[model samples]
Target: MAKCFPEPYDAVSESKAELLLYKALAEQLGPDYVILHSVAWISRPGGSGPREGETDILIAHPVRGLLALEVKGGRVSLDYRTRTWVSIDANGVAHDIKNPFDQARRGKFALLEKLKESPAWKKLGIGRFNIGYAVFVPNVGDGDRLRGPDAPAEMIGDRRDLSDLGAWVGQVLDYWSGQEGAGQQIGTRGVDALVALFARSVSTRPLLSARIADEEDVRFSLTIRQAAILDILRRQRRVVIAGGAGTGKTLIAREKAVRLASEGMRTLLLCYNRGLADHLREQCTTIGGLDVATFHQVCHRWIERVKAKNGRDLLSEARANLPRGDEFDHHMPMALANAVDTLGPIYDAIVVDEAQDFGDEFWLPVEMLLTRPDEAMLYVFLDENQDIYRRSAEIPVQGEPMVLDRNCRNTDAIHAAAYSHYRGAVVEPPQISGVEVNRLLASGIEKQAALIGTLVTKLVVEEGVAPHEIAILLCDPADRPARERALQTLPLPATVKLGRVEDFSRGGLTVDTVARFKGLERAVVILWAFDRCDVGKDRETLYVGMSRAKSLLYVVGSREACDHILAAQT
Candidate 1:
């Protein structure tokens, strides 16, 4: 097989044409060939808006030299009058695209100029070798029919040519051999020079941020497999999605909200956590019809709206009659229901995440706030495994709930550690083989804090990991204050920033409990599982905390706790 750049191709490449050509080139070509996908460069830094030239696929063969291939996938046709290429998308939408042959020619020249800057190119004098350009249209067949004034039949690879790529390459080489300065021959030494020159631009450590991106790449592939469900959601009036963590519930909810709002519906996206709500709000800021907030935010907004209109705060009157704990439990949601009743239905649709935390009282006003109670779209995403808050969660929706089975967020190691305590339907672990789950033993609270602090310092100062990428989660929120005090005791550098998730981007390190940090992820997570083992409720808390780490995970606890984890892994 041919050696490919990045070893595994990026899952989210925009051009399906290029991905198809990349796989074919990698599998069918001999070991001597090197294929690079999406070879991009900024040609002129001082240009008006920075000129970028990207070759879809650059194939290097020792004897054939470099071939710049531009691929066009969908139904391709040409406008005779304007000289523009037309692409018919899956939706039967026709859009004008640039001529593929012209693109290949430009990319070929730009790459040649860039490659000449390498010291090896001048020393070996391989610049005189055949440097060719070709257009590969995987969707269109019969290369002879594709011939035009600028596009020669022999220089184009069509659908039929894909079956025998080697034969097609030979034909292309033969055609290019007749060109100027053709076939001086790029020998083994010349190919080595090209590969060596390309390697220098990409030599660096795979940081935590990069690994998290790799996880997202795998998640994206899995998410694509789930795209069929979007049609089902569109047809249904109400849906309650049931899944375990990493099954892409939050991702689906975000997409659903965006789609509904884009269609001019007044949509409300609700979640349990404030941090998650803030993140959603940030994502949908430019989206006009989408109102994303927490359950509490919905109550506060409605209650305040009523007060602003009538100059009477219904919530304050309700709070006077309710007990201390009953304020949020009964007073707030009831006031919201009353406020909704007065204002009538304002939202056309409502989507909820972490629905497992929403109580029966919470659902009363949610359904009432929808413009058409019977027909309005309602989506509820829930993972019962993460019911740490333990509410009634009697979501007022009707359906034979859709189940998401794959856990696409955490790696195999993090997945194994978390799912051990979970008691639910099977959720398949991620396929990526990430770093091993580390169980570091520390007897006391002080020792645990010291271990985490030292590790954080090493990650930030020594290893060059950004401070904002690390999060320290406490198993028990009650122990959060003591842990924070302990972590601050160490004489660490001022660069190591530690705060809550709201200030997380400000400080590289965030300190929060597992409950608050739910529905969020960081690159590195130091979980303080020390002596908080209750075997009952703590299992759910442990599951949520451990899974929050997307890349690197470390559990600091007592020797017994460490031993328990070790035994489970074995």
Candidate 2:
């Protein structure tokens, strides 16, 4: 009978296996055993229909009256902890199966009531008959095994030996029949009354178990670049991340924060600029629940509620708690001393963004934030090339800084141009494709603006790009006037602005200085009013500016200005 049933029994094969297993059992047990296939037992009082309950197989012998058997064909492994038995394939992925032990228990009670309704039981003059249950795993695997402790009416083994199974079923039936009159009688009641009793009993019994099958796929460690960064954060008590523009320092810091949080460690994410800090906060929020705040906010809160052993009353005072501008540049060690006085007894983990813009004075407060050396409490993210406002030396700290060269957000042409412009710098371009970089020479600011208008029109009308995708950058802060003049002359409806806002949501070109648009990116980037004198100082900045474009880059400047831009690329 087992041989006739399909191998690797799925939904289509389930009915076939049930029929085969029942026929074999009936042929061995004779007419005394009343066989019931696909018997659904709904434990809910008012529930109706076949869908209300789970169905398997049930058998009732006359002398050994009511019995239930749940059948399956395959290898099964039960996780004792989760109380789940998982079926596995050749590659070791889990196959789904209903819990046989649970099915048998439910079927036993349901069949007991069904047996009491029979006319044969009345003719036999039996007040109450015995009830039995069993589960058969037909094709057991050599390596597969069960995990949970054994239970009554739960039999898990091969189904091929029907004779031995029949004998076991008879024994179970005889045991229950002997104790029938001794115990309390299950009243001959309606389906509703029986269902109510079943519901109460089920609440005490375990429902279903969960399990995970062992997989064969090989797992690997992090890449060399990722490992280098993780190693630094893991080893150092306090360290700063400093690198060239587009090095992904902030991304590394964010990834570290997430990893530490997942490990149940308390971590704080800090950034200097509000825009960058807002961006970090949004990213953290998307990652679900995590503790993150800006540096100033953290300091304010700490000052408000000093609870640690080294807490000070000075932090509780509003005027004494404010961060002064002068404290930003009073040398590294002295700055550390002052900051330590203010924000002492450091956090468990501190992650700072835009570390380069922070002066030597910043490190003073940072040093005081380290609560332990071996526990590793501080991490900083910075881009050295983006430091256009400060002249402070890079704070020398422990930990080998990891460098990320992957230009994941830009095209190959943009990366190539960026690398060519900053030749000796540590800007390693990522492997990518699809973009064009062009250097257009104009007569002056007026002509540069005119050329930019033409390029924007071409990118929008001809290339089918959106206006919001275009960004016009000015190396000189004064070049904003020329950019605005160009916007006024263009036929397109758009506004020039220093940064984005809610009102300027979409379908408009934005114009800003290179420094102001440092962390932003666009689809098309146009640079206006470049001069020969600004070439060397703006080399790295220009690289960062051009790389912001996803598909196109247009640089409009005077002949000499254009020559300098083109020459720097070579």
Candidate 3:
């Protein structure tokens, strides 16, 4: 069982006779031999007679050195008068082909010249070992017809010699070994050197830009996991999609919205994150029937419409009556429901993304906006583990939920760090492998902030990363003083400045809270977890920030916090 260069060889030639001979040789040869199919070579300038040629099959034998075989597949013959070779295929078509004997000789000499330049071959003293050339006409039966001045009957093989090809090969090797200093042993080392010199070794990492492009292409390609979700959406009018982070819920929601809008259904794609809504708006603006907005944005629009239709200032009236903390959160959704009930339905279908973070009161307004409250289309995509807002992930819809647990956004390391606090259905990690999560330990917030500054400089200036692709997320954004100190104290490049998450496309790193940055992703993320405590409330906050990074992630925190994470993971 000889090992071929391309295992499970497929013929590249015009005829199948070469495949037949390849099988015969591969089966007849021993394990010590290597048969490379269709070995191509280019002669160095001022080195060999022929410029370039391809050897049908090159055999590397430890005992007999090297052998090149030129195989002519189909009915082959020679025109005696003009001394030219002719071939006729099974289609009754005649064509002229180069003499296989001449091809074999050129290929043999070219290979010999190639090995002579290899330092390993020269040092091993097997550079000038016996290199033989032979021709094989698999369709031809009579060897006498191929016998000529150049094509010796003993050196060539025909149809009768197909069986026991090893014996015929030995006969060819013996004929070439007659010349002085022709038969030399090529040990295992020589064969290794030959393979190495021909098939060059690659020992370098890929470019970051190339790696990013490749991963993006693979990541975005529609998988059966997503298609099945869409198929379910088409069948069911009301559905709930439950999954963990990176399960592609947002993608599924967007696709559903586009299909509904294309069918001329007034469609609304709604999400919790303002930045994500802005991004979706830009994408869906050209669409005639589609509209994208945040939950609050939709609430405000309907509230204003109610005021215009009827002389009712719902927002001001509700603002005065509602509590200080619940002023905007509770009233907007309540007011939106009142406005929609009075003003009637505004959309045929509504697809809600990041439903885990939306207030429980928001679902009433969402359902009321649909043309048919009970019969119309309503799809909710949520990740229970990503409920960073501490709200009850409630949707007053019917039936069981469909889950997408195969994570496809963040890298493997990022997924692990984020899912550490996850408490739901098991989530599969991203297919792409990445560097380990960077864990930097500092004593306090000031030290961690300074370390973040140094990391920003390195990632931007030294690593050639675009500033806009970077983001800094805070776990404790309610602490206004800490947020300001972290962003101002960082020693970032002069060209790189801080901007809001939604409006940083021009040039700037996005600075936002982890909860606000949900449903959005960045190529690079620096999570501000300096004061991260092992509490249930802090669980999803850090997970949201960790999962937001697609390519790179840096976790800067206190020494105690860092030790806790590392030990727990270990």
Candidate 4:
């Protein structure tokens, strides 16, 4: 009597166990009855291939046509709370074992099919032997301790008790052997007959249906990128969003925030930097939607509002309750640590923008705030390619990424030029039409500025394009002297070195850093200043800078830099 009977057997274990059981049964029941295990019995055509089905063991006697057995080894107790059997361990941890009667009933149908294939079965007449169930419990702690409702099977406390088993087996054989002369009984057809018999035998009723009602659809509209983000949010209980500059990752985040809020689900929009948080907050406000704040700000509000209402000093409490492996460094921000400690779960969804820049440590507190399997979802947006601070920044996301490939904003020419110059890493080209890209060589800063200024005048004045539709992008904002000269020489009002929303006035010509202008699009012209010599390493910066334009790209660079762009185009 093994204590670990029916202990989580897989296909191989079940096969091996079946073989051992067959040998044991032959010795106990004598040579009269036939014992079979793991027999492939197929009836349904063009359905799933024959695999493991219910009946694991079958016994047939001259009088009895077939008998099915389900076995297990454990102390079973009735769960008064769950109204089921509670199979507990030595440490009192309970496992809800599925009922053995259910297993026996399923096995009965499978056994009947196997019986029909046997010549001996037809000789005895299939209806002569009465089918029944046997449940073998090998190591019952107390033999008479019955739990829950009785099952369809004749419950045996211990299979090791050969005297009791041998007597019961003999009686069943004799009764069926006497009935062999009885004419074949006409019975109700198919699985329904066996199911009805098994139901009458078991005290606990069988489940009649397993279907559940469908859920109502939630109404929402989103761009492809935004829809992809929402799909990930719905499928993966945990996720990260990474995007390069100008990919509209933040815009996607804002839309997600609005949708979640509309559903009356609390949503949080988090950013690593305060400036980006402020920017998102402004955008969310303009859209008349959810509250967007930096993670630190959220924590500060919780400490001041939530902890105060509870009359607890959150900082002191956190210091006293610090868990192991959570030691803090001196340079870590107190506000961040306090927020991580005192922050209440206010949001159903937590969307983090600039996720790539938010290092590994930034996620530790955020992870604590998430509710497992339900209640909350996490979405992080980032761009590995636009990660200029990699040497100093610790990226939080680990593994190959789920990338958004289709360029929804830029034109094909713009996307093509960007990807070509940037080692062809851009996943898909843009969908827009009527775009042209040009590469020009200049020896110095003044020459580069003159070329950019000429392109701006031609696009705005000659082509009848608006000045606001044109953009002048510099790889490094520190190269402002040339940017200023170009803006001063241009024939229209020009916005120079604009990084934030505040810097964007009623537009004419917009000038900004390549990094800042990554996710934005412009019509007519993009004046990219590739003033540096290490053009190969800076190719991505140039590519992203040039692709911002809808109609035309005018790249101004040194001859050595221009050669790299020409080679990329080829």
| Clashes (candidate 3) | 0
RMSD of each: 14.2, 18.5, 20.7, 19.8
lDDT, candidates in the order shown: 0.76, 0.54, 0.75, 0.52
Question: Where does model 4 exceed 4 Å of error?
Answer: 1-229, 242-248, 271-282, 286-289, 293-334, 343-345, 368-375, 391-401, 421-426, 489-501, 524-527
Best by lDDT: 1
The residue-by-residue lDDT of candidate 1 on 70-124, one tens digit each, is 8888888886578978888778899888998999999988777655543456677
Off by over 4 Å in 2: 1-224, 227-244, 286-346, 370-374, 394-396, 421-427, 479-482, 485-489, 494-504
TM-score on alpha carbons, each prediction: 0.62, 0.51, 0.60, 0.50
Which of candidates 1 and 4 is the stronger one according to lDDT?
Answer: 1
Worst 10 residues of 4 by lDDT: 203-212
**What lDDT is obtained when candidate 1 is compared to the true structure?**
0.76
Error of 1 at 266 (Å): 0.7
Tens digits of lDDT, candidate 2, 1-570: 221111213113344456666666655665444444554431212211111243355554433455566776556677667776777654677887767778776667655543343333333344544565667665553322452455443244354455465776666566556655323333333222323222111111000000102211322223346445554454355566655544556556777776544333456777655545655665567443245665555554554454353454433232345445343254233433444565555445667776766665556565566554334456777766666655474554665655555454456777766656554436555555775668777686667666777777777677767666677877667656656766677665343322332122345566876766665566677876557446566675676677667567787777777667667555
Residue range 1-570, candidate 4, lDDT tens digits: 211111223122333334455455655665445555433322221222222245555565543445676655455665446656656655677788766656766776655554453333334344534666555555454533443355412343344444455566555434444544433432323222332222111111101001101211321223456454554443343456655444556666666665555433456788655545655565457433267876566556665664666676665555555533242321123434455455544445677776655555566666555433143566777766554334234444445555665655566667666667544245666556754667667777767667776776566567766555556777767767756765576544242232332354333356667666544555544455555535567765666666666557777777666666656656
Q: Cα RMSD for candidate 1?
A: 14.2
Colliding pairs, model 3: none
The total of clashing pairs for model 1 equals: 2
Between candidates 1 and 2, name the one with more favorable TM-score.
1
Candidate that scores best on TM-score: 1
